[model samples]
Structures are given as structure tokens and as C-alpha cells.
Target: MTANLSTPPAIPAGTLPAGTLAAAPQPRLPAPGGLLLRPWAAADATVFLAAYRDPEIGHWHTRQPASADQVREWFDRYGADWAREKGAHWAVTGGGGEVLGRIALRGIDLDDGVAVCAYWVLQAARGAGVASRALTAVSAWALGGAGFHRLELDHSTRNRASCRVAAKAGFLLEGVKRSAAVHSDGRHDMHLHARVRDDGPPA
Candidate 1:
């Protein structure tokens, strides 16, 4: 008997439905200390540009918007990413509704229930637990309500601040990826951290 090469084998269903994220409007998550993670808005162009222009932020995040128009375009792309269930981005706002930072889940794979988290805060917002709080809030939502199984984040090994934020958010330190990231200075080792749905709440 000849094997049938044209037929493909069956695969298991995805962990989440296709419309899990796109079916509903993106939500605004409230974090501790009166911080809110809301969808990015058109009016955020100014602060978005300013964030990229920040030396530390620029050094870490290499993609910088050259103008307000470019920033707006990026915002549009972010919305599109949401509709496509490809990614989710949020503007971290303070009690007064001022943009203090950003948090996002990139490279989403619903079938695998996995994504990579990224975030940054303005200089004024640093040293205040902004990143950790926002990160923890988002992780809870993603793993609980959104049905994601795992979330991962990595940063240059030299960035002790980010390491602390990841730990505070309950992302256990996995291991190091040698020369895995590039920064303004040069290529650097990256420390990988991750949280699974079973990790429970942040301690």
C-alpha cells in the first residue's frame, strides 16, 4: 500500500479561540497605586515621541519615531495589531490621566498561548514600581481572562532595573541568552524571565 502524501495530519485546536482578543474592545486595566493601562490614543503622540527621545529609553528601545506623524502611524499599527489578534499595547497612565509609560505583549501566538512582554517608563516614573505594577496587572489579565498560558520578557543583563521589575512581577528568572540582544553600546547577554498561568499571583 502506498502512503497518501497529499493529506495533512490533523492538529489540535488552539488554546484560545480565533476571536478571543479581537472580538471585544481592548480593556483598560487598573493597576495598584492608581495607575491605569489604557489603549494608546491619538493625543499621546507628543508624549510618545518624547519617550523615544529619552536617552535611557532610546538606548534600550532602538526604534524611535522621528516625528509626531510617525508616532501616530505607529499608534495606528498598534490598533491594527489588536484587531488582528497579533499583539496588544497599552499606555500606562497615572491618576491624572497622564501617560507615564507603556506596556505591550508582542509576538502573540494564540495557538501556543504565548507572548513576549515589553515595557518602558518615563524618567519621572522610574524608581516608583510603575513597571512592576503595570506588568503584574497585565499578566494577571492575560493569563486569567485572556487565556494565555505563558508570558516571557527579556532585557540586557546589564539592566539591573529591568531584572528587578521582572522579578517583582513574578516572572521567574529562567536563564541567560548569551549575546541575544543589541543595545546602543553593543551586543549584550540577555536574561530571560517568564511567568506561566500556574505561577499564581505576584508575591
Candidate 2:
């Protein structure tokens, strides 16, 4: 028999205050191997555009900015999201400040102390643990100083590299959402993963 999918009953009030995230400046987190996770800048439009242009990124991300102007607009939106406490996005950069990847917490729900994580590494930076390092840094900040209780990550089941990154970053596989995500080719199942604050430190 199919399991019931009704909304669960509401619990107690929010774990954190309303302005918990917005009250503080977005931090520039340090990752392993001299990598840095910082807010996106207006000058990053060029590399931002290039990231979406990559075939693999395009295949999974599915949305692209048509021009530098569009990328700037996206940067603006990201700033607004940060101000509104709805999301947080960061650019993973090398020691020389070269853009290496992107990481973010989307769909932030302060009431529930939860958010979803997303990330992508540039083609040149792949296989160097860039994504995992960025993810681990963000997760630590989110669950520790940021006051978030849980962080969730989901990716297309076919994206084996992403699955590996999640695992390496301490996000345990929760389950699959059958045919839950749409890709360039068609719909595909998604693997859901999560790391809660109580999970303790990463191995």
C-alpha cells in the first residue's frame, strides 16, 4: 500500500531568531588547500558566464545567463537573497582568486532551522576536491556559527561525482526521490542526503 503523504503536525516555535542569518555579514570561509569561499562579485560575471557554458554544468544546472549583464543581475539577486535571509551563495576561489566553483544554501527556512545545499565545480577545478571542500566549509558554518540545525543536499542520481562529494562532505544519503528532478535529457531520480548538527564532526 502507498504510504500516507500528509503534512505533519506543527511543532514548537523556531529554533533560531528571525534575523539569525541576516544580522551578520556573510563570512568568507576558508577551505582546504588554500581555497576560499566568498561572496560573488560583480567582476565575476565573465567566469560565471563561462561556468554555465560548460556542457556538463549546462546538463545538470539547466539554466544559463545569456550575457554578462544577465550574470550581474543574478549577482544582484544573490545579494538580495542574502539580505532577505532566504539563501546564501558563495564562489569558491583559489589562492590567486581564480574562480574554482560555486556553493550555496538554497530554500532556507529559519523556522525549521534547515536549508538545502547546492554546488558545482568548474571544469578545470574538477577532481581536486574543490566541491567537497567548499561544501564542508559551508556546512560547518551553517550548522555551527550560522545556527542552522540541518542541511540537505540533493542531486540527480546519475551525477555520481556529486554523490561522492556529498559523501565526502559528511552528508549522509537519506533516500531517493523517484523521477523528482528534470535534466537536459529528461526526468531523473534524485538522491537525497542530509547532515544534521547532532551528527558531530566530519571524519
Candidate 3:
């Protein structure tokens, strides 16, 4: 279930101390390929709009953003999410700090010590392993200092590329949830993966 960040939930038993996620100073997280994970800015609304138009992004996430206002609203929501302690979302930026994609740890359930991680890369950056690098870096931070016990990720079984990303980032395949979600195409089964606080990277 989703967390109500406006009122931080009870911390899980083995996770980090209470207020750990809510109290941290927001900043950019350095990553490979000169990538920096930072909060999305209003300036990136156009880029955000462009990325969601990619057929693949629309295929999975469903509902293409029809206007600049929608994207701007999404950007605003990301900020609000952090303020409410509900979750964190970042714009994946390249060396020059151009928005390349987005990555987030959402649906945070503090009492259960879990969050669902998601990412989507711009078409220009697709083959460069941006999603994988971002995923690995964020997962490490979430499980380590953030004091999360587990991070979950899922993709439609049809999304073979995402499955590869999860495997490369050390999340273990749990099982398939039949007809777990609906996409633009139709009802789809979801392949689940997870990483626990003390679990080693999957080989």
C-alpha cells in the first residue's frame, strides 16, 4: 500500500530510524556516465512531455501526457511527494545536466519497509545503460542509508528489457503475478523482482 507522507508512517523493525527518509537534505546523487539524480525542475517539463510520448513509455505506463501543463503538474507532484514524505522522484541528468529520464522509489510503505522502484529513459539514451545504472545506484541508497528493508520492481512479462535491467541490478526474480496489471495493450502478467536490506546481489 502507499504511504501518506504528510504523516510519516511507523518505521519497520529492521529499517533505519524514524524520519530517516523524511529528514535527509535533498540533493543530487552522482552516478556513472556523468549522470546526476536530482529532483525534477519546472524547466524539464517539456523534456518530460517529450519522453512520455515515446510509444514504449505510453505502452507500459498508459495515457500519454496531452499537454505541457500535465507534465508541469507531474513535476510539481514530485516535489510535493518529497515534502509529504510519501516518496522521492528524480530526473536523471547527463553530464551537462540535461534531463535524460526519470527514476523513482514510490508507493513507499514505511511500516513494511518497502518501496517500488521505477524508471523510464529517453529514446536517445536507451541503449546506453542509463536505466540500469540509475536503478543500481538508487537501490543501493534506498536499501542502505535510507533504511529500507526491501525494494520491489515489476514489469509486464512482455518487457524483456526491463527484466534484464532488474537482473543486472541484483534484484532477485520472485514470481509472476498473473494478470496483475492492465496496460494500453491489454491485461498483462507482471514479473516481480526484489532486493532486501542484507541480501547480496544476485549472480
Candidate 4:
């Protein structure tokens, strides 16, 4: 059977008509507590740098604290990528104008109906359901507009917080790959999870 390469099937959080998945776009989404999820702008780099400064964030993320020049370059390349649709990133912000984290749908494959969802939230934002909300909003858009059927997420085995976020986002534990990569001291295991289009509900 041929997949719909143009528009992905919508998996609405709420009930809808039988053919709604094939119908118009779902209502625009607002992040939890009316947080805004939108594309990152150049001015948002300070927030990015601040969020990355936490040692905990650096431990999991390969990239260290970004330099001012590096942040500019990063934003430049980020904007270009989104403009070309190669991939996209969004900054998660609270109603009070605090930057919570960033979520991205990279490695998009329209033919295969798949993409990679990756994110990291500030320490203060942890356990606040921010990551889950950001993920849900992005997943709905990808499934409803971008033709993605499966979304994969990965993290170092030591990142329990990330693992919890994946579960909260409705991704099931798939498997683990030993020595997935070389860490500062040695190899590290990687946890893999996925949420298929048919999955029940997203937290």
C-alpha cells in the first residue's frame, strides 16, 4: 500500500470524526500553561547558552557551553536549515517568558514516515511536564502536517530524566544498544524508544 507522502495522518489528543485524520489541520496547539512553542530567533541565543551552562546538561550533550561567536554561527545555520526544511528546531518558553528547553525534529523521512525527536530542558524545568507538552505539540504537527508515522528518541543510559520524559511523551521502551558511543571515560549504553502513529495516548 502507498503511504500518504503529502500529509501525515493526524492522531488527535481528543476524539474526532472517522475521517478527521485525513481532514483539515488540527486546532493550533498551545504549550502547557499557555507556554509558547515556536521557532528560535537569533536573540534567543542567550537563553540557549544559559541553559547549556548547567554541568548536568553538558554531561549528556556533547557540545559544551557555546561561545558568543559560536552561538551566532549556530543560529545562522539553524535558521538556514529550517528555511530549507532540512530539519527544524523550536524554543520552549513559559507564559512568564522563561526559556524552558528546545525540541527538534531532525532526520525527517517523509517516505518512511519517521523522524527523530530530541530535547533538553533546564534543571528548573525538570518534572514540570514541559518536555512532554512540547513533544506532544510537535508530534501532532509532524503526524498531521509533515507525514511522519514514527518518532524515535535516544539518550545515554545514564540520562534517567530523559528516559522518563520519553515515557511521559508516550514512547515505549524498544531496546538498548550497548557501548552506543565512547564517553569521557569509556563506552556508554544507549536507550532507544519510539512512538508509533497507532500508539494510544501521549502524556
Instruction: Count clashing residue pairs per candidate.
Output: 0, 0, 1, 0
Candidate 4's residue-wise lDDT over 1-203, tens digit each? 98879986775443223433334322334666787777677788787888777877767777655576677688677666655545667788888867788888787554466778989888888888899888888877776555567889888898788888888878898999888866455678999999877784685
TM-score for candidate 2, please give it: 0.92
Better of 1 and 2 by TM-score: 1
Ranking by lDDT: 1, 2, 3, 4
Write one digit per residue (lDDT tens) for candidate 2, span 48-104: 999999999999976789999999999999999999999999999999999999999
The true-versus-predicted C-alpha distance at residue 115 of model 2, in Å, is: 0.5
Best by TM-score: 1
Q: lDDT (0-100) at residue 69 of candidate 3?
A: 93
Candidate 4 deviant stretches above 4 angstroms: 1-29, 182-185
Model 3 CA deviation exceeding 4 Å by range: 1-13, 16-18, 201-203
TM-score of 3: 0.89
Clashes of 2: 0
lDDT of 3 at 120: 94
- lDDT, each prediction: 0.94, 0.92, 0.85, 0.74
